[model samples]
Target: MASATLFHDVQQILTAEHPDPFRVLGMHTVSLGGELRLVVRTFQPGATAVSVTDEEGAEVAVMECGHEAGFFEAILPRGTSAFPYQLQVTWPEAGEPALMGDAFAFGPQIGEFDLYLMAEGTHLRLWDVLGAHPMTIDGVQGVHFGVWAPGARRVSVVGEFNLWDGRRHPMRLHPAQGVWEIFIPGVQDESLYRYEILPHQGSAFLKSDPLAFTAEVRPATASKVADLTKYEWNDAEWMRSRQEGDWCNRPMSIYEVHPGSWKRVPGEDDRPLTWREMAVDLVDYVADMGFTHVEFLPVMEHPYDPSWGYQVTGYFAPTSRFGGPDDFRYLVDALHQRGIGVILDWVPAHFPKDAFALRRFDGSALYEHADPRQGEHPEWGTLIFNFGRNEVRNFLISNALFWLDEYHADGLRVDAVASMLYLDYSRGPGQWVPNQYGGRENLEAVAFLQQLNTTVRDRHPGALMIAEESTAWPGVTQLAHLGGLGFHLKWNMGWMHDNLSFMSEQAIHRKYHFNLLTFSLMYAFSEKYVLPLSHDEVVHLKGSLMGKMPGDAWQKAANLRLMLGMMWGHPGKKLLFMGGEIGQWGEWNENRSLDWHLLADPLNAGVQRWMRDLNALYKREPAFWETDFSHEGFEWVDFRDVEQSVLSFVRRGGESGHELLFVCNFTPVPRYAYHVGAPSAGRWREVLNSDAEPYGGSNVGNGGVTETVPLAVHGREQALPLTLPPLGILILQRED
Candidate 1:
């Protein structure tokens, strides 16, 4: 190369502005006097002198300072070829000279095929290709770092290994793939790192790795190097059963919990329980409660506690707030071992505006829309993902699989799905952008969701993809190939809202608002549903389930038991947020533990007992779940008793001949002889009564048995004249 060109390249390396540092800063063959010669170049800013050494640590040649900024170069003896080498440097103030491998010495670590997949946005195992992965390259052990930053002038891996200096370890850019990578030998796991990106038009700034598997606890935003392959999981049986079992026909009673507030150590400043601790305490609690699964609010790394893990920053990491990534895996394994499935609340709807996160990454709207109308979320003060971008879609889809594949999560309850389905969500007219078809729908997001569901369904046969969508979007739980959203289940938000509203009305007014109680049946079988009494209803001063009920404390307790019974007996899967089962009076607070002391109160204890018994009975009876999404599973005997605020229904297990009758009395008034339709004409046993004394009710119900008379009623061949409890529910099954 010409002397002037060499000087300019050396200057670019010193200034950290070289787009491709590998070409000018590493060993290369150059022409000298019409003959090719091996030349080695390095940049060590603080070194007083530098020497090139062979693989055996023998000094090969003393390098001369090619620039005043500590640029060093050496010409090897003629006839030499490129071989393994290191730099031995002498510092004026350091006690000893440092010997280190040249970050630019290695060739591109990311394979061309992987790069092509990444560019195509079809890299299913993106985490494996992009991120700080500790591996052995060319007989040398080091950490290989890769990131996508197409618009950046330069990208460097800045970490403690390089004294957090971008100039020390500028990465090599693969121009065709828009990926930058460097294999920094001696960089080990648990080291903190960030990417220093020099945008095309502005100053350079450091951003956390988008594919970090573990991150520093909040209040510190650096990404930590983690080894995901080390965790030895012991849930083989659980995984196998999960893959083959038919989850839709099985009973799934989920106990939703917020890890940070579920329980806290009073003696330790009320800090939340760690993952290992929860592995024992929370696992035992959920198991004893008879819940089939435990759904955690997002456990992914997030900075704001108030957002309740909804505003995600780190997509691949399990939050370090509880413990390391493996600790979380241990918790999941523990749950699986206890015969409990785990569902993680995944938030791909939006992300916070933290500077160190994905915001304006690579000095462009790489992961989000550049236009505010399309990129911004007004209500959340967050940023919407640009689903149209292939790489962005890949990032999210890959993240969803990461939890299910790496963490062994049985399902993912996708959060704020309604926000992603529409372009004008939570927006007024003129505040949003329309798609190419000029419709309110977000076509890109819809396509992304369809692809996401299809990929998850194909990859994990039995794992669930549940949507927490609140809109009236058709076919949410239908098959994607049939023009549906392809969700295994969707939360029945309409049922929750209508029922809660009815339950809150006074007994006198409940009769007037009877439709609220029976209106859900009209569309209950439209989709596979999970009737969720989730955290959202209990937060933001919406009040706790207990507080939402009308009348005195006794009536409130009875009402809560009745509500729970209705939810379980309804033709849908169930999910109850923590604190609801215990009749907690206060709304949920993310900052503190649940009111555990409420268990001391008999009413609260009774509510808890009622929930446990309800779950036990629900799981034992396939009638409640076997034909959940089909009208065949549910038959309304009578919803016409509106004047008395009563409802009666029969749930049947198809072909199994298993049947259960659910009769609910919404008002606090006992009826001595209310005739209810029976499915058969034999002995019917009272399997569960919410009004039993054990559940803090008046105990007004049949004495464990009722005989059906041959009289016709509600088009059935038999009828049962039974005593109806006040504000209570009774579930009866035929003995013969």
Candidate 2:
């Protein structure tokens, strides 16, 4: 090649403007005087002199300064083949000359098949190839870094090893796949790093790795190099049982916990418990409370605490506020060992507008939409993901699987599914764009959700994909092939709203709102459901469950017990937020621990005891959940007694003949003789009564057992004359 052309190439390398750095910066073959010779080049900005050396530290040749900008090059002897080498550099201000392996010496770390899969947006384990991974390549140990930035002019791996200089280790770009990769030898685990991306038309900026397995703690956003393969998981039995168990029929009483405030160390500035601490404290509490699973608010990495983890920045990383990635794994393992499932809240609807994260990545709206109408979330002040884009879809779908695959999460409770389903969600007409068919439905998001559910179901059997959908969108819990979104379970927002509203009404006025209590059963079997009393109901001045009940102190306690009894007896799974079981008076505060002091109050202790007993009873009876989604499992004995503010129902255990009768009394007036239908002639034992003295009720109930009479009532062959408890529910089972 001509000398002038070589000088120009050297200038480009010195300035860090070379699109493909490997062609000029690493060892290569060149023709000189009709003979091919091996050449080595490097660009070290502050170095005074540079030399090439063999693997054994023997100097091959002293390099000449090809340019004044610290660009150095050397030609090896003729017939010298391309081989592994290191750069020995002497700095002007230094102590000893440093000898380090050339970051550009290694070949492509990502295989062609992986590249093809990435471009096609079908890479299920995208994190395996795209993030910083400590690996051995060609008998050398180094960290392989890869990122996707199609619009970037140049991308470099910048970190403490190279003094955070972008020019020192410019990555090799695979033009066809728009992926840049480099293997930096000696970059070990726990090293902090980030990407320096030079966009096509703007100044360069730094971004945390989207696929980072772990990140620096909050207030420090650098992504950390983690070795995720070292943890020895002991949940093999839990995993095997999970795959074989039928979750729909089995009991699932979830204790929803916000890790940040579930408990705090009063002696340590009230800081939240670490993952390891919670593994013992939180796991023991959930197990002793008889909850089947624990659902945590999003544990994914986020910068802002006020958002409560809804606005995610690092999808693949667990938040570092509590502990490291392995610490989180320890928490899950602990839960599994205690016979409890772990469900993580996943947010894919939108991400916060943090410049250091995914926003305007590559100086383009790459992860989100280019148009604000389609990209921005009006209510959240966040950016919605461009689900229509194949790469973006692949990002979110793979993230969902990442938690289940790496962290051993038994399920994911997808957040804000209602927002994803509608293009105009919280928008005022022109503020949003319509689909191609000119409708409000978000077609791309629907397709993405379907694909996400299908992939999770196919890859991990019995792993739940739950939807927090608040709309009447049909078939949310149906199979994907049957034209549904294919979620295993969906939160029943309507039931939660109606029942809470009813429970808040005064006893004298509850008759006017009787439909609110009975309305849920109308559509209870429409889809698989989880009746949730979540954090949403107890935050932002919405009031705690105890505060929402109408009446004086005693009446409030009675109403609270009645509400929980109804939820436990209802035809669905259950989820109750923290602080509810102990009957906290104030709303949930994210900044402080739950009101553990409330347990000292007898009324509050009664509520907690009632909740514990309710879960135990619910799980012990198949009639409560065995056929929850079918009409055959639930039978309303009577719904016409609105004047009395009372209702009766029967839960059946399919053909097993296991049945339980539920009679609810909303008014504070107890009835001495109330007749309820019985499925057969037998001694009906009062198994559980929310108004018992132990639960702070008046203890007004039948005397343990009531034998069925010969007289008919409510279209049944026999009837049971019973004493009804005021503002309480009684669960009775046949003893004959």
Q: For residues 372-409, what per-residue lDDT tens digits would candidate 2 score against the true structure?
A: 99999989899999998888988888899899999999
lDDT of each: 0.92, 0.91
Worst window of 10 by summed lDDT in candidate 2: 1-10
lDDT of 1 by residue, 366-427 (tens): 89889999999999899999998888889998998999899999999999999999999999
- In candidate 1, which residue ranges exceed 4 Å CA deviation? none
Task: Output the worst ten-in-a-row residue range by lDDT, candidate 1.
Answer: 1-10
lDDT of 1 at 374: 94
Using all chains and alpha carbons, the TM-scores for the candidates as numbered come to 0.98, 0.98
